[model samples]
Target: MRCEDGHDDAAYVLGALSPAERAAYERHLATCSFCREAVADLSRVPDMLDRLEADEFARWLDPDHAVEPERPRKPQGRVKTFSVRLLSTAASIVLILVLGGGVFAWWWMGQQAPAEPVFGPAVAMSSIESTSPIAATIQLAGSESGTKVRMQCEYSVTAEPYNFKLIAYGPDGEKEQLGSWLARPGAEFSMDGGTRFTQGALARFELVRLDNTKMLVLDVK
Candidate 1:
């Protein structure tokens, strides 16, 4: 049989396969390492289910009993009884290890999962001289690659052609020019821009004109 047919290992272990199909899969298992490993892995599922059923039965039989002593029996073959008990104990240990390892793996995967992005509260920009009509707010969102910036600005357009420059200053004096834009005169203008700096690494954000005159500055903490 083709290796693709090995996908029925779960059904085979659960006794869901027909007699003919089970015979064919056993023959295929002899030559297919993938199917063999799949069978070994899935075999524990039935053992776990069986353990659960046994626990339920025991609980139902004696709900109030804390510890029950084994009843003495007539001397059956000592060696045969010893061997059976040893094999049963070994099987129970293997099942516990398999089920415990699976639970630990699931917990570890959950712990390592990526968290949702958290955004910092938007901080409003304050003018240095107190007479500047330019208003702005800056916000930062944490991401896997880097922190994303969102800057919103409201400017009083008094000059003829509005030539604006948005700059982000890093904590270490590194400066990045975000972008530039133009707006019409005698009208209130708003602009949106972004930068690559993380929120904590940013020292300040500034909006200025082409002539190097600072229009607005936001001190970051």
Candidate 2:
């Protein structure tokens, strides 16, 4: 019903339509928007053909006419026509199913997956004195149910002056990265909001302070 499907209708009027589809299309084109557009697009074909044919005829009759007919380049075929049509239809079906499946899977996962905890350490963190000159302890707490496990580090800066980072390791051998904010000079400094946990029965969080030390561990059971 759109103006874009211009084809065969023009070819039909020019008697170039395949015998199998000509009558059916001509009858349909009498009132169809698609057919109308197709005919309109093809209208120029006849005029062009007529001009070339007439010029050729004239030149043939009189050497003085001397005009060469410009032969239009024929369109090249890629895949066979039937194969292209079949492929197009199959591709459409696949595209629809893929999009539909993705939407359905997303909704299903959202509904079935348990919510993640906000902040918590899966295990206990031990401060490293030998590794770095920094003396710090990391503690963590997280919501039991939400979207992800959050890690909170409550640590102090020693006289040696140090910076640290907290790292969390998931059970699947994937390490979830929380951030290391600088411990404020006066009071305990804490950082939260680590990674999103999606669709696993259980996950663990471990915090490693820069100076590469494990300060605290919280387990989301």
Candidate 3:
């Protein structure tokens, strides 16, 4: 039940372990962080199952396929049921928070979208002119110690009061989002985004607007 056991512990936690093996593994998990985290991740299943119909849960957690390769798709059925009832309720709460007394909440959401990138010669990013509200950059890929190439710049988009998207591109042209940020006239922001990559050459990171689609390249290394 060591972290090294990974999905192996997941199987054991699910009672998928053999009687003898389960007893041995249970002893091991008492002192294992990896097993503890795996169990927590799988614990989400009880609530998910409770939210699903009896038949749906039975079908989803089918014993023949106890080792599901991915998370189950969202539940689809009457919302009045305990399983699906909170789905829309949760979404409504998020929408309400984003509105949060803003007069233009509807308008802002209509024009907003996540960031997109065009690599190599196709990029046409405008220069950020504002020196305030410095942009944050993070290192997402590397060894467990998280060595990375990163950089920072200032926010200069006219799309006020909205966060920007952060994306990273490797030397070989792979792209991934680091996350998003709310723009302030003059402030500093930073975070550590988690991504896995084997040791390799350097990669590039960029910050782009959620609207207007502008981009600014940060430093590499």
Candidate 4:
């Protein structure tokens, strides 16, 4: 995604980075929560694409399935017209490249041992146990200075908004609030954080509501 800091994390997540670039980005990932979250957000895209077959994706270039153009309307001035086709061959090729070429690599991944995750080691997340209506998963990817935490939550019931904080407790009873958000119902909530405590050092993570209610808790696993 887009960051005001001009970080092109999309490119990073898409495997477009050179070796040196990848190393630098991983170093930056150790500290930048924005970039870390961007990585998590894009991590699933490749897996979704992994479901498409080469033959199926090739259908995008099938001329027979081309979308018929809408009725042409007279323009008042010298307006430009655009093609109505879903995708041209050249555009389709570029689309495949931008999708990280993972669709084509599906066969390769299965023929051998499992390959690396598209978004590196930080992509896989663990589930948080809770009896509440809220369900969520969390991941703690360690960094030299600390660990990058990613949380994905699903919530929906009413149109109301809920406010909450992600609290991290250190081994010695130290506490830290990673971040907070006003979550609106009918949507998923994603957040990122970095802490000095590695995954092993943290006692647990508590999703505490503004009213001092513990909505969810994730113990070390």
Best by lDDT: 1
lDDT of 2 by residue, 75-168 (tens): 5476545554554444333332443356534644676664543343343444434443323333343333323333334444453344655555
* Poorly placed runs, candidate 3 (over 4 Å): 1-142, 145-159, 219-221
Better of 2 and 4 by lDDT: 4
Tens digits of per-residue lDDT for model 1, 1-221: 12477568766876779999999999877544346655775676445444443334345446875555658877779876676555554544444344445763474457665465565788887676657646667777754333556667665666466677778887678777666666455445444334446666778888787886787788876
For candidate 1, which ten residues in a row score worst on lDDT?
A: 48-57
Q: What C-alpha lDDT values do all the predictions have? A: 0.63, 0.46, 0.48, 0.62
TM per candidate: 0.41, 0.32, 0.34, 0.42
lDDT of 4 by residue, 1-221 (tens): 23343255766766778998889888777545556655775565565555554445556547466454558877735323233122233343355454455753464356544332222232222334433446677777776555667788876666468887778777877876677778777778887667667767878888888886877776764
> Over the stretch 1-221, how does candidate 3's per-residue lDDT look in tens digits?
12444556546644668988888777755544345545664554444434444444345335564534556768655653644545433433333334346533555446654233212222222346544334443433343323332334455454356578766565577665545667765545554343233225335556777874655665454
Q: Considering every candidate listed, which one attains the maximal TM-score? A: 4
Q: lDDT, candidate 4, residue 84? A: 16
Question: Which of 2 and 4 is the better model by TM-score?
Answer: 4
Mind sharing the TM-score for model 2?
0.32
1 against 3, candidate with superior TM-score: 1
